[model samples]
Target: MNALSIDIEVNEAHLRQQFEDCSDIVFRSFKLSDGAMLLLVYLDGLTHVQSVEDNILRPLLFNGLPQGEKPVPSLAERMKREWLPLANVQTVDSSDALVQHILRGSLGLLVNGEAAALIAQIPGFEERSIQEPKKEATLRGSKEGFVENLRTNTSLLRRRIIHEDLKMESFTIGSYTQTEVVLAYVKGLADENVLSEVRKKLGQIDMKGIIDSAYLEEWLEGSSYSIFSQIQNTERPDIVAASLLEGKVTLIANGSPFALILPITFWSGLQSADDYFERFVFVILTRAVRYAMTFISFALPAIYVALSTFHPEMVPANLMISIATARENSPFPTVIEVFIMMFIFDALQEAGVHLPNQLGPVGSIIGALVIGQAAVEAGIISTPIIIVISLTGIAAFTIPRYSATMPFRLTRYMILFITGFLGFVGFAYGIIFLLIHLVMLESFGTPFFRPVAPFDGRRIKDIFIRYPFWIKNGRNKKGGQQ
Candidate 1:
């Protein structure tokens, strides 16, 4: 227990021991006009040296206590209000608070015969400038994205919505990292019960560290063990602001560009930021295409397997001939061929994401073309199966959010396996079971498949089609519920 009380020398020594061997820690000791000792400690890279020297050091050293007068009305208070020229100053008594403040880019000032220390906020660390969003690019929305700094992200949110009802509740999670987590929502719009549930879940996180916003997403909502994303992740601030306006809660971490939006529904996966920005007709067409792509990505492989194996009549005569000719030389069954091509496609997609930005597109194209052509020529896989998997891969990209694509990828394999053995019936059963499971799931007490499963007519306007802005008003007030 490192405690600072009265004796300035002992306090300095204790702090020095606590920060032993830390090269970046700067400690300076000086004497007042009446010969009282004072100590100052701060981290070199974190605190502003110019502010410390000009605002704090010069003020105290040049205009400090009168020749024979002692500090009146508590030295800590006087120094904080009159002496320190900085804008933000806090008085802390415990050594733990001193350490926390010092580590967070604040200067710690210890006065002789005083038990408390003054914490001056003078943060001067480097941070990246806000740039365009990487993942969720928009053609018509705001271009600015959230940076890694918590304060900057909060400022971005405030700049968009100036309403006093907007509230940001902050907490320090991660015992070792002490990472900052902010839950933002608008009062009177957001549900109090959902907010309480979010707080309770966050309080239950007993981990040693939280590296990013993903950590909180996993801890808070990953308990249901579902493949589909329960919380939507967005780099665009407008998307977050829009969600807040809809009574949804968003969580922002200190060092992460992505924000976690809770009470997300399946319809969220198909909705894009551009939907609200573009004309209603265009948005409807775009959302319709995305919905079609999502369905194709999830069921194309299984549908192909089921039709070719059990229901040849479903395939047109000319297409059947072409497919039969393409599969004539292939040695593997239809299911095996689909599996082989899908595996290669998945590998290429993963490689494209992990590769360097400049080479990612080139590598994916080359890998797909070379491997796909070689497999066809060697009779390792059929051309029809390659086409099926390639279309599925392309369809997976149509979904606006990356997290929403996982369910499609995983469900594709399940449907393929089921259809391989039981033909068309298995495919139908697989989809039924999947939809049933999704209907049972909830996101922070909101239905996962909102406005669809429960069948709400008024709020379902934006589900399959993008309705006009005026018509959609007050639709989402109930959080997509009746």
Candidate 2:
């Protein structure tokens, strides 16, 4: 609605008024060799002065101005076509668009009697250079990771997957932040129904800001109430590319290094990039260990409570004697003892994480060695309980993804509470309840407990074990069609 006037001074005045208090806004007016007036407007820190000067100013000054007395439209057209030698240039007719262009680090050139402003692309701002992914490091894959810049991140994905079917659709979310989010997928590989659902959910997001890809994970997911993450988030572009090749959609948001890969199964959380890189035999063994760790982390405490309280005979005679001897000096019951130890373990883990990086490991060592040993020596806790809690903590570290670790921790507490009340029966009941909950859960309309719960034998090869590349069933070359 705010159309530019033919008067150069009037347009400058409007710009000055709009950016009154902003001292960083620059408006430099100059005259061409032929006495034609023009103004250059940009934000100081965001624009590269040298590039603008060399690309735009130098070309205009050396080439001379467009000749003849013509209308504003003709002059503007002539300027766009024959004048500015910059790579990216556009003409803006309204003040609103002009301001937007300037804000995005483009140089705006307004001519004396022209009704439009010429925009030149020369954005310059400091950004973190591409580096190895911090969170999701791979032993044998690409070391390059996604950076904060959206264009750079998309480029990383593009480089790995060079194909015409690899499509990326961008959307602007966040009313205040106006953050850019791109949904990328292979056109035919990804299910149309899943794509439709994802787009619909994305359109429904009306937040004031989406700071990270995690912000979109919950909002885009069907079941927000579930503790388990239906969508997977990773920092590596190779992982994103792999997911895209496997008929999954990836969401990359500006200002965030993490990208979300959707319609992922519950088992996907347990899988890692390392699985694909390692030999199939070694991968199976490694995965088995991780799966065992997950189980131990979630059920160790509850199983101990159930067996010791209700079925002490289940334990070996020598171990039972040792456990009974350890607990003899402790005043609290078995459940209470376990609870205290778990709380202390949780607190120490939290402290270790939140503390300064230098002190984090030191704090963990002191808490584990000093506090735990002191507690046992004082008979405040049993040695066996300490050992169990320590094992549980260590097992949690084996899981590749933090999102999967959370559900393990949550389910552990739930199982512990149930076992404390009804012993072995309650432990079984809690696990059954959890299994049912997981089976009913859905991720982007895809089954959360896929291949395993549905018992798809053909697809099970990649679920628990990674098959060798040569031996694996191949997906169709055209978009991974089954």
Candidate 3:
């Protein structure tokens, strides 16, 4: 039952029973001029019908075997070597393998009096065309983005990093889906330990299916409880090629357009795709602005709450008087007002994301302006709090990665609550704890706050400022080997 039988009827019956009730499974049988009965099995939409008809059916039915040729031991072997016009053809001995091949858009040919089956690769599935990345756009760089097709994505990487050392290892992770996942890296350049760890983690995944690269990210991350993403994902193949050159590993799944990059650092989130494409002088200024805005986003509201409520003397006399005058008519405390405004801001943002593209931006902007003005005019919220919340929202938008912004958003609320209660002391302690947590985190054994927490003076330059390519001599020292 496991292996194909020499009798065509036995093999046909076994395969039919295996694929019973499968409406899309095609079973086409025909006899050769020499009277050798052949059966072709494949999925309906997945297999290329034209290629099968022209190259397989037409050749086998009309051409037959070579005239006066000696009898070969296996009919499948002869067809694969001379009869078939296809390039990718292989033999499978077991019925299980034959079924798997057929499912994966391959044509399975079983001949009379032969135990072996020939599998022809001719996959034809609809997929999105490669377009510019929607999220990680840059002013200047390659515009091509990744599509859902696995082979097409790999080809994109190969086109960029054309070297023999660029190696890819394939894995089938999903139990039912049997989705393909590829791990790519530069040989000898990537750290052996990191590679081993990636392999071990991937093998341990017990999921029923992996629909996207994000699924692998959860399994690959060393710290599952942490909010910070250990693995970076992007739709741009250029970014993937850049990561591979730096001695990092990438995971590209079959159905997902996003590719996962590993051993990422805190700096990775702050860095943008435009950083490398633009001039270093411009990049340095942009990066500085981003870092500054990142801090403002995380601590602006907390600092305001701490000073206004608990440390009034620390604030200037004029600002304190102005804050008090603005808040005179508000019913809630400063902390409570901030919490309410923050909640509304977050809800509006979520609404924007879920809404259609035509209305998302317009609705969020109009909603925020209208809601904030209405609250302030109605004396429900103070004017100063509105300004602070608006500034904080803008600052948070400066961070390039959407994933990176989430942790800051969540922690901002926590710090705001703590600062409201304990003032400056609480704000300081919150920052210290966040830094400690970041230092403790790792991505596939690479320190999360690399070159900063450990204080690598040499590598620190790339974090605070973009170094020109001329001065760089070797691969990235953070996670890759020299």
Predicted model with the maximum TM-score: 3
TM-score of each: 0.95, 0.93, 0.95
Arranged by lDDT with the best first, the candidates are 3, 1, 2
Model 1 lDDT per residue over 110-171, tens place: 88988888888899889999999888888887999999999999999999999999999998
Q: Model 1: which residue pairs collide? A: none
In angstroms, how far off is 42's CA in candidate 2? 1.6
lDDT top scorer = 3
Tens digits of per-residue lDDT, candidate 2, 164-282, equal 99999999899877788999999999999989998998999999999998899879878888889888988889989999998999999999999999898989889988899878899
Which tens-of-lDDT digit does each residue in 151-242 have in candidate 3? Answer: 99999999999899999999999888899999999998899999999899888999899988889988888888997888998999999999
- Candidate 3 residue runs with Cα over 4 Å from true position: 65-70, 83-85, 474-482
Scored by Cα lDDT, where does model 3 land? Answer: 0.90
lDDT, candidate 1, at 259:
92
Return the candidate ranking by TM-score, descending: 3, 1, 2
User: Whole-model lDDT, candidate 2?
Assistant: 0.87
